[model samples]
Target chain A: MGDEKTQVHFGILGCAEIASKVCRAINLSPNSILRAISSRSIEKAKQFAIKNSLSESVKVYGSYEEVLDDPFVDAVYVPLPTSLHLKWAVLAAEKKKHVLLEKPTALDVGELDRILDACESNGVQFMDGSMWYHHPRTARMKEFISDPTLFGQVKTIYSSSSFFPPPQFFETNIRTKADLDAFGALGDAGWYCIGAILWAMNYKMPTTVTALPATIRNSDGVIMSTTVAFHWEQEGTTATFYCSFLSHETMDVLVLGSKGSFHVEDLIIPYEESSASFNFTSGASFADLHIGWNMKEQEVQVHNELPQEALMVKEFSRLVKGIKDSSIRPDTKWREVSRTSQVVLDALKLSVDSGFKRVYI
Target chain B: MGDEKTQVHFGILGCAEIASKVCRAINLSPNSILRAISSRSIEKAKQFAIKNSLSESVKVYGSYEEVLDDPFVDAVYVPLPTSLHLKWAVLAAEKKKHVLLEKPTALDVGELDRILDACESNGVQFMDGSMWYHHPRTARMKEFISDPTLFGQVKTIYSSSSFFPPPQFFETNIRTKADLDAFGALGDAGWYCIGAILWAMNYKMPTTVTALPATIRNSDGVIMSTTVAFHWEQEGTTATFYCSFLSHETMDVLVLGSKGSFHVEDLIIPYEESSASFNFTSGASFADLHIGWNMKEQEVQVHNELPQEALMVKEFSRLVKGIKDSSIRPDTKWREVSRTSQVVLDALKLSVDSGFKRVYI
Candidate 1:
């Protein structure tokens, strides 16, 4: 392991769109390589490998387990449908392979807990594929929000991520079925919004959540739309978030404070060269007139051009390399993120199941 | 009832700041008159009446019951703390006086229902004083949102109204005491936001609600911060709302549709002279580049300078005058408003009690 260039070979469990991004990142990153690709159809897997320019050194498997059994593959990235996340994550853990699972991690808390336990017991690293948290821009936003001088007493946070889903995206398979824990906009897109809020707010699990889900169905009786509001509190600060997948494309985060408000607009898969503007109000009065003073706009330019998937892979590689370092314990952060996501997902399900009642976590 | 003007002489149940505005409006409006004022002390009531330049013809009562019993008073305005709202409202209805109660008509749905029954049995109109609904600007907004051709398909509606409570406003008294049903932020402010969304969406009850309440506290313990999210659906449109008393003053509403989105800044109590802008994006694609055209900003010149209390008085006056008209059915509208408010309040409580479980109306 000294200088043999300890490259961690990876196998993607599904040839999904997200898998393409991860494969591209692995191919581009120095510490990792795309070793194999698998799909339900061997033809699809071979086509993906060929299109991505994988050499004869890489294998295309017809089944997920075949790819998992590849001794050369040190880890697995599960880009399968949400319902399949837990099963494959646990399988990967049982095989003693690191797991980089997609957003949501699992359909519900029970599944998430089981996967987490399996990974812990097997001594396998587990990380949710939340690229936004690894993005440098998010780190900057988090730092700015936490700075008392710059933000001056956080008051309210309003975030929205809404876009029309791919036509028939909700009707095809497990993703659209309500019984599978896949329904409406929240499960598909709102999860990301909730994750962003939780991360920025320092994993402040909402004490109680009253959610109202707007249910919309496609022509085939599949759910197509869901809107949710999350009321969150930590310490003395209270934040409310609005998310939807029914409206036209919109991705923005607004933070209001005692002194002023800052807004990060168009944050979805945010461009690498994107910059955020801050509007600072300077006065005691909440009036617009007072807000006009020192209402200066400051822009923070983010120059990192690394694709989000690459950043996520880079972070995971760094964590794996640092596993032997006594100070570098990934389990603490992993547990917090996993628990927060599970709590939110459970709260959401409770709300949905109880007709959108307030559920305490 | 004939050519002679029949004034609805009214008395205030509390010497609230809103009551002062109502007294002024009563003096200014021709169809109504301020007959008396009441408080815990006669001297305070006298001073209030004198400061407001009420005529010597007007009387000052020492207690709320005195105002209710005064024969000169034909109607009553209850602006007491939230917990006391139901009690006083019930008393006013029992006294056979038409009542214009403030927002959050009652702490709970049962209380509201009882108030409604009492009002109906006593043959008096019990209107929830949601003054914004009567504003000419709100009427225009309602008309715009309802117009299918202009707006096309309504996808989602989001609104936020937050403000800090007055100092010591959350003491053991009615509005702040948890046991007294004085919800911190939801009861104080969230209700208005909910009412506004309901009004805009044509009284569509939310199918389900998930609410997260702040920690409950009193002088001895933590009283919960009131925060609520209501998800409502009608036809295919989904509406989400966030309201709190914890946020720095904010009032905003965003309505998203297929063709475009309409945004109302400072919607709770908008600036008298500001314009309402509509951003229209027309195209088959959901991308921003497909945005076609936007209508020019529409400036709404509000010539009327009366405050909310004044507006409520004027609207009530009109309702009272129209009560005798064969074509008018103000009680029907009042009942609807009361019912809607009750449903929202009840749904919020259910969310809280059920650990923020989703509850259908």
Candidate 2:
């Protein structure tokens, strides 16, 4: 992913580790190009550019303001800390730059609403950095679960997104700092769980959100791990998700329906870059004598030419290009997805903070 | 499996649907034989024997008392409903017949205790018919999870057991009758979920059992579906399970540890009879650039000469033979396993009955 023909110029407002991945995605996308990168220190920005082997033509800036002020930049990918997202994302939108904000979009729905309002008023397209939605495998899974005969109504869903971080992370990582990333693992890893569940439910909010009593927190009162459950009364569907920084690496989601079910072990990142697969079964039942299943779970494989992150950038740039070239407005789908996920995340937070009470949505 | 050389003669009380499967298993095991089959009516017993293609040498008893009175019968397989377990199991034990009981072992632990105590006092062996426990795959999985470095400490576990039964099943099946199988799906299907979770935790009782508010019941006040949670305060481990007769067939168990994880889509009954496999990954981490996994989950296959039910019969017969010939005491392991499962099952029922309150174990 060296450099692609540029249609939309992109600027990154932070040097977070995730920013490096997005920077490459910008360069790889067919209609987007990396224009600039900024950190608090110009020296640090230069080091980050060197570390990621950025092209010489890509500008390096000392502060985020410089990137927003650059007239050529059409979009900004904000990978800043959670506490800084409201300020930086609104500023980018006000500067008339489309925004790809990292998740959990903001501290709470109030901050998310302010950011969304700014993007709407400024007429700038907004999307979160949940790259998995752009993976072709995701679309394939949705197709399977959406089939009336094959999948029927969803009965239950269970998702897990976790990783065991090194001991040093507790001492220095911004996620463990209340002021920097107060939501901690619930914001970092739990974002994917919420997004996956919401995606399965077609972004419909849950009737209730309840945190399990096993929430673990750091000394700074920042969550390190938690489990939450969601109930959709109308659909009679329930979902439970566990996100943690203390468990081994896992990005798994299982959805069971009346007639069919599917499981994906690597939902966030495919085990391979070029292809991914999930186990699916339809009309399964006990074989005669109850000795075995009537059907085995078939592994349905899906291939993609580009990685999910690149597809995400390509999709975002396509929306930005539409508004710039024609009179078309921004697509509201992505913002709505982010907003629903944020609202649920906020409810889970409230449930945990209130001694594991069940919070109605 | 034609009749094997007979060592431990088995007389089945109640020609329930599951009895046919176990009937075949008895004939398949090397050291076991089906000596007698019984039902309340001799005609029904004759019908069951004919339908299952039982050997002419197997006797058709008019009543369960007739099977127990036969001095040649060394063991009895009881597939009677939960309401009849206490009366029949204790009677079989008192008759000096080893007991192979179908599970949700009894209506409650109190009844299960009486059955176990009768077996102890009569010096007769006891085992519940949970066939999966005897599968070689179960032993292999136990090895993987026991490894200190490869699997590390168990962090969380999730189990699901569900199937969408025919509508007629809800109307006429014994499971739907209040007095026949009071626990309904909770006793029949949820039994496997509880057994699997406890098996993974080495049969330790959970600190607390909490049933979610999603319990669905039939008109007879029998639980048809439910979701429950278990927390092990000492190990900092949490487990959740969903069991129902209202979803597609699934017997899934997922165990996540500090350094490894595994998922088995078919835990109760394997997808195949001759061999089964589970997806396992140990010491897995993100690949460079967080684009993919460093290692893919490996599918570990385990093969068995006999099916799981046959293995279960063989194991139970072996223990019975040791006690009958060598004057050795009956093995306590099987009874202990059944006791723990019944204890947890009772807790789940109590939680559901008490308005989804958390029950301390």
Candidate 3:
């Protein structure tokens, strides 16, 4: 968060496809340095480094443990499949390297809790790799929704994330393989939608989660597409989301309060890397004779100095630096939000398995 | 449809708030003329005519039957409450006056069927007053989703409409009165959402309809806000929608297909009265390294020569003129689509009443 001198050194576990994005992010982040990368096949790891044009100073490791054992690596980014998250993340935390894990953080909340405990016991930072949370537009949108006078009491939200994967991905990708990702689309895409709802509620978990009818799964019992609804009884707020790998790419979030609403079409990834915009309306009443709106919605554009993932890396690195130089405790907000998001995801999956039943959390 | 000389004359059944919008539409439509208006009190009807600046040739009647009985009036526009639709619409059909009925056409499918039967027997045209269906943007959007190469198979749709009504309106309006608009928010706002989904699916009804949990009701047992999910097993297509009267006003329709998506924020009422725009993406693929999209979504703008409601009036008038001049039988497509939409709404209401169970339609 301060200067490059206090930079946090990061080593990535596994040369997964997503690592390319994160590797570039680590390079772009001012307070973060790419230290190493490890993969089961050292040849694949070397290829990835060369393809991504990594600096010559960055070392490549043959095993995940080699990267974690490196004393110079201040933190580790785990982009492996969901099944390997628990073991590698816990091992990294136990090794006293701050952990930034890819989302659907675990197979279930129990595993997520175990990883959090490891980080807590070892006094290292923990953060889920949900890049959208670090976007500057996200903070601005939150400020608008939280305004009582302009937005009123938040009442409802609808979020969805979907992408039509290639035919080969369905047959060969780890996401569709049950033992590898297990939760499939629910774990991969649904995680972002669930996190969106929780983030809009300011980390307040819903009291009930109900799966919508028409959940589709592959032959291997992996969810391909589904929709779920959430209810917060005390706040009288409700949210619903649809996720899938069988549909076109779409990521949207719409939040409605008493007096205003906030809507964004590309929530997961902005349409442009340099700037993003969202629609906001306050006190929108009907026009004369109700033919149109009396108040026009404002499309507020937010400029980004760095990409969202880079900002995420910078934020995580800042926390790791605080623990290293200032003896500061790790931020609990990130851990709490990630844990609550996983809890909702588990309840949704349970509801789907139970035939669209309402699951109380 | 033929010429202004063959213009169809219209009579309004009540001075409902919606009538103000339609009255102007009838005047703007070249093939339609507002002939008369009726209310419980003649004074109120006269005041409505004056307030809407109706032509001096337009007559004012004290009773709905008076307008239906007017032989000079070729069609009757029924904007009465949902509870009054069956009685008034059936009477208008029996009088051989083609009927344009406001949405939430009937309390349930039984009443809708009765109204349809009366229209069929009398050889009169019937159309629902969903103004958005007439928007030029709607037709263009449909053309995109129906494209196989650009959009592919339509897999899912999400539609929602909500508005924060004044506190007093909830207490006094017919929508919140169980005996008047018995379905409440499900009738008022849910109708448009259901219609949007049905329109996207080419008016095909889903096999199953399930009400989502988090349904809120007033003390009168009228729904205040709710969400419903629709599933078509044969087509492997699904839809979900949320409707409310207690939250910030929002109208959004998002359709996801195999190759592209169609999204509109203000589906029901555009931000402007003259033209509207919607976002469409075709072949949206992830960029290299999956950091962003390769192609940006295009915002397609559609200019309207006539207001949506005016276009609706013109279309209805054209059908009325065809039946009157050509001795043609009533077009069944209008009745069929309205019937399917009502059937889905009935199933959703039944599901909600039965504790959010799946109702097979």
> What is the DockQ for all candidates, taken in turn?
0.14, 0.73, 0.66
For DockQ, the strongest prediction is 2
Q: DockQ-based ranking, best first?
A: 2, 3, 1
> For candidate 2, what is the DockQ?
0.73
Model 2, global lDDT: 0.92
Give the per-residue lDDT of model 1 (tens digit) for A1-361. Answer: 2122577678899987667678877765667777889999999998988877787878889999997788888778998877887889899889877888876677778888898888888776778887767666777776777777655566556666666556675455455665554644666566677776777667877665544455555554444555555554555454555455556555556666554455565455553223323232223123332111122235665645565567778777666656533435445586668678778867866766676555677
Compose the digit string of candidate 3's lDDT tens values, residues A1-361. Answer: 3354678999999988899999999989999999999999899889998999999989999889899999999999999999999999999999999999998899999999999999999999999999999999999999999899999988888888999988899999988988988788888889999998998898888988987667889999999998778888887788888899998898889888888998888888898898999999998877788778887679999999999999999999888888999999999989998999889888988998898788999
Question: How well is each residue in B1-361 modelled by candidate 1, as lDDT tens digits?
Answer: 2122477788888787666656766665666887778998888888888777788888888999998999768788887766787788888888877888876677677877888888877777778766666556676766666667655566666666665555675554455655555555566567677776777667878676655444344553323444455554555555545554444455667766654455555555544423222233322233221221122223344444554445667778777767634425446686787688678877876777776565778
lDDT of 2 at A290: 92
Per-residue lDDT over A1-361 for candidate 2, one digit per residue giving the tens place of the 0 to 100 score: 4335448899999899889889888878888999999999999999999999999989999999999999989999999989999999999999999999998899999999999999999999999999999999999999999999999988889999999988998999889999998899999999999999999999999998888777889899999888788888777678888889998999999999999999999999999998999999999999999988888989999998889999999999999989998857989999999999999999999998998887899
**lDDT at residue B50 of model 1 (Cα atoms):** 79
- On DockQ, the stronger of 1 and 2 is 2
User: How much of the true A–B contact set does each candidate keep?
Assistant: 0.22, 0.64, 0.64
Q: For model 2, what share of native contacts is present? A: 0.64
User: Which candidate ranks first by TM-score, i.e. highest?
Assistant: 2
Cα lDDT of model 2 by residue, B1-361, tens digit: 4335448999999989999999999989989999999999999999999999999999999999999999989999999988999999999999999999999899999999999999999999999999999999999999999998989998889889999989999988888899999898889989999999999999999998887777788888999888788888788788888888999999999999998999998989899999999989988888878889889999999999999999999999999989988999999999999999999999999998998777889
Worst 10 residues of 2 chain A by lDDT: A1-10
* Residue-by-residue lDDT tens digits, candidate 3, B52-87: 888899999999999988989999999999999999
- Which regions in candidate 2 have their CA more than 4 angstroms from the true location? A1-6, B1-6
What is the Cα-based TM-score of model 1?
0.68
Q: Judged by lDDT, which candidate is best? A: 2
